[model samples]
Target: MKYFRVDLITATPNPQRCIYVGMHQDYSESFVGENRINWPDEKKAGEICVKRLLAGERGHYGPMEHVQIVFNIGWFPHSVMQQARTHRIGVSFDVQSMRYTGNRINQVAKGLLDIEEVFYLRPIGHYVDRKGRRYNYTQTQRNIDLQYCEQAAKRYYDLIEDGFAEEHARGILPFDYRQHFIVSFTLRGLLHFLDLRSKRDAQLEIRELCRLIWPHLENWAPEFAAWYQQKRLYKARLAP
Candidate 1:
């Protein structure tokens, strides 16, 4: 369908400063709230945060939990959500549910929406399997798959038209129906998610999701993102 996008909903402002305060509070006996008046700039705070807390892989992730970010993920396939939910760790999701929101399906049935707009299919290409088997997904195969999706969508809509419940009618829909969702994570959780999903072995769609998320993180916490890009990104978890 040529659409997968992420929009930043909200994030803790001055995240590096938050991290610095959290990290600094851990070792300080005084009330950090008052002492934070002397806190450095976010960039410098992030540099110090990296130096003091993450430089040698200190394994101190508590500070990162203080910063929170949320995103509205749009037009990703159900499979991506399925895969991401499997390893959610400490993330939260508020997905568009078929049971409650079926306007797009109705649109498809009324010919107001293209099936391609409501569903996702991998483009014709060579893709690798978990066993390292590389196979070409031909256009012929894709067309056949498209037909199956079309049939399924027709059935789903027809059932709905016949007074079937959304919960029941949704059972006939394509497995890869495009969905929008809201997801939130702490700074540490976000990096850990990237560690797991941005790897070379991860599914392509979710990997693309992580790719879209990275820029937002970079803009939010430049120093932390830079350190993560150099160390943890697509390599290994920064901590247990």
Candidate 2:
């Protein structure tokens, strides 16, 4: 939780109004952008879009694709990105590549970066897996995992120093190494992603990623976020 984050990079200004404009364009005989004088303000526009673009009888979503936001995701494990990438339609990602970057591994090997900063382990706590089996990830097991990460980093760095390519040397690194990525999504795409990753059965770390993304969505488009929170958040209500 300490390292995981979602920072907003940029978003469409008056995104709710932009969504409404798209909706207006779909039906208006006249051009919508040219009729901005009659368009609703951001909040009002958000309300209108939710009602017209996504409400029960008028379940239109094409206009939601018109609004977009970008984020810089930080320090989530590589596995999180792996899971996040499964739903790629209308989504874009530029992830930190271990193949081209080995400074963090070197830093860990040199005792500059803490092992935990380079790898992930679940906190020592009880957890139940998909089947009804329950178990505890104790402190001792976690300590062993930390040691494993340190050893892997050292081996990876040693291989690099011995003229191994970064890509070749990285084979020894842990699967859940920390990584950062830049991602952008259309509003509809964002909703579709949340529908999958924010559900009860989703992996815990990826759910955390979805949790982190929500605040930025709310701040940028309050009305849409509100509608989503009430009707869709965590319910696995797949966005159409």
In terms of TM-score, which candidate is strongest? Answer: 2
- In candidate 2, stretches whose alpha carbon ends up further than 4 angstroms from where it belongs are none
Q: Name the regions of candidate 1 deviating beyond 4 angstroms.
A: none
lDDT by residue (25-138, candidate 1, tens digit) is: 888888989876699999999999999988888867888999999999999999999988876568899999899988788887777888788889998999999999989999
Per-residue CA lDDT of model 2 for 1-240, tens digit only, reads 878989999999999998888888878999777877999999999999898877673558888888889999999999999998886558999998888878999999999998888898888899999997999999999999999999999999899999999989998888999999999999989989998999999999999999999999999999999988888888987776
lDDT of 1 at 120: 94
TM-scores, each model vs. reference: 0.96, 0.97
RMSD of 2: 1.1
Q: Give the number of the best model, judged by lDDT.
A: 2
lDDT of each: 0.88, 0.89
